[model samples]
Target: MTDRAFRNLDNLRASASTARVLNLLRVSHEHGRTDGWRAAPLFENSTLNRCLVIKHRLRRNEIDAFRVRRYVATKIILPIDGSDLRVGGRYIFVDQVGFDAMLEQALGIGPSHPDRKILALIDELPSLDPFLLREQLRRNGHAPDPCYFNVSEADLMRMSDFVASEITPLVDLSIGPDADLAAENPVARLTAKIMSNSAGEDMSALGQTLMLRPEEYEEGVFCWKGFLYYKWALQTITGDIGWVVDSVRRVKPRGRVDTEQHVAIDRAKEQVRRRILITCEATADMLRVYDDAFRGLTREGRPTAFRDFLRDAPILFARLGERLGAIQHIVSFWKYRMTGDRSAPGAEELLDLLADFETSLSGRERPDVLALAA
Candidate 1:
């Protein structure tokens, strides 16, 4: 062979271990063989060794590279199916027989059992140990001898020929059947539908809502979605008060009415509290709502609005505490009422609930006041 022909042959030979070579051979014989020969010209033992070295280096330096590389090596086995063949524990087995069969079929050599011979070829590789392969290649003629040299050229030619004839036809026949089966599979259909839907043009309402420049609405939606997802994932887990507070903090008042919304929320809370005092029923539940509404208002830093309203309604806070017998919520109202020259009849009851509410709301009690109360 001329230098060019030898180079071309070398390129083709490198790919002998690749599925691409088998796939090419399976396609159009004339075109594929010519392309393989073209590829052969680019091959060199030095280049191949360098590739192997780089692969080894990447395997050592990168996480999961060794595992993935090993997996890729396993995929090189067989009818070009590109499936992983892992045997449990000590060692991984490569389907050398299947590889040889593909080569034989590619070269138009013999029939089925030739694949078994390919497996034998893997066994006969220069050295199973990668280190040994590197060292041997370095010692003798620089580069591991081509695998084809381990077996006769005539045998390889026969194997390649068999692959070209029989295996290619079989693969062609199976592709149609496999495609049909894949199309019929419910999971496959669902996957395709999902993929198609994902690719389809669709405008997001959330995106539109965000574009409206309402930061509070955007934040509320995010908080709602996050809470919904959390609740969905863990039903037993209660809502996150911190997240709710954070969401409320993001609410930017759009107009005076938005400020009034805070007032409305507080008014609703006071109304609920008033109804509880008047009716003397479900005070705890009403107080819980009132506390939540206060928290939400405080999250928006509008507690002063409620405080001003409370200043006007001193009798409400005083009477509520006296009727409820110094409950924490009632005492909290009394504590606020007494905070600035506004003493009520339940001022003494303020000590415990004031400390408790301060602890609950601010996550810390006023140490001096709490100590004095104790």
Candidate 2:
């Protein structure tokens, strides 16, 4: 059997098709053993290919049958590496969501269950110093280098034993019989929907809803789902409005302010506002910009652009009402405070605002319509 397997390995090397089969078998055998299966070749396609190759090569040999049998046994113990075992393709990190799902399956946890999260598994490593662990593994004849630390595909199979021991029981408890039906889970369904729709028209529609009005903010846009959506223009209020007015006084002094120049100024302010608002910053920073813009407005022989901006403010709010209603409400509340609007929105009013925004999105527009409207 050893001799036969060895001869088969050699024959596999000689023919690309047979080699592929043999290599595949070797990988399966290796993987099975790594996963704590019996450490022997399981008769799979690669193994059969290896055997066929050997049979073809040795058919003309005049060796006695007994000797051939002995040779086969020896060959099995020393089979050569086949092409199938090589790692030649690219590797990709599984999506974070998928990785979390796999972990739950292996560890018997739910997505929201904090006790069995990946962080818990990571924390379970022996608290021994890394230096000590490296030394111990090395003393046991394992090369404990960075290469060993790196988790390869082969390593993943090998580690499956550890995973099975620690994780399988937990998963069994968490999932029960229903675990077999991953397709029915709402989270899984949502994840699939999000992935598929990430580059679609919904993203653009969402973006358009977030845009700011020229009077209230600035003129900037963001691209989502392959389309550009206009965003609130806080940038103009903070950056361009002051500078443009000052520049106009210096450049054209008494001449009528250029409409093109005013537009450019508004555009600059819009860009700045979007950057500042969308950033993950504390509320105070946003308030500062709001306060400054308001203060600046108090001094104006208000530019026509500013008045036009106020006229279009409702449109911006309506669109923003559609994209991120919660955020828009926060902005609206703040805007009201800045403008000294006495009436405060109630909780039900906030919910209604959000509901109305969601309702508007029900009629999905064509990509072209969304792009043009945006």
Cα error, residue 121 of model 1, in Å, equals 6.6
**Per-model TM against the reference:** 0.13, 0.14
Per-residue C-alpha lDDT of model 2 across residues 270-355, encoded as one tens digit per residue: 43334324331322232233233323333333233223333333333222322222222223333433245544333333223323
* Total clashes in model 2, counting residue pairs 3 or more apart in sequence or in different chains: 32
Off by over 4 Å in 2: 1-25, 28-30, 33-53, 57-59, 66-77, 80-374
What's the TM for model 1?
Answer: 0.13
Decoy 2 TM-score against native: 0.14
Least accurate 10 contiguous residues by lDDT in model 2? 221-230
lDDT of 1 by residue, 1-374 (tens): 01222123334334432211222222222232444434432113211111111001011233243322221122221221112112111111333234344434444434444333433343323222222222223333343222211222332343333323322222233244345444454333322222221211121332242242344333232222222221221221113322322323332333334454555444433443333333233323323333443343334444443333322222222222222321222332433433467533222222222232232223111122112111
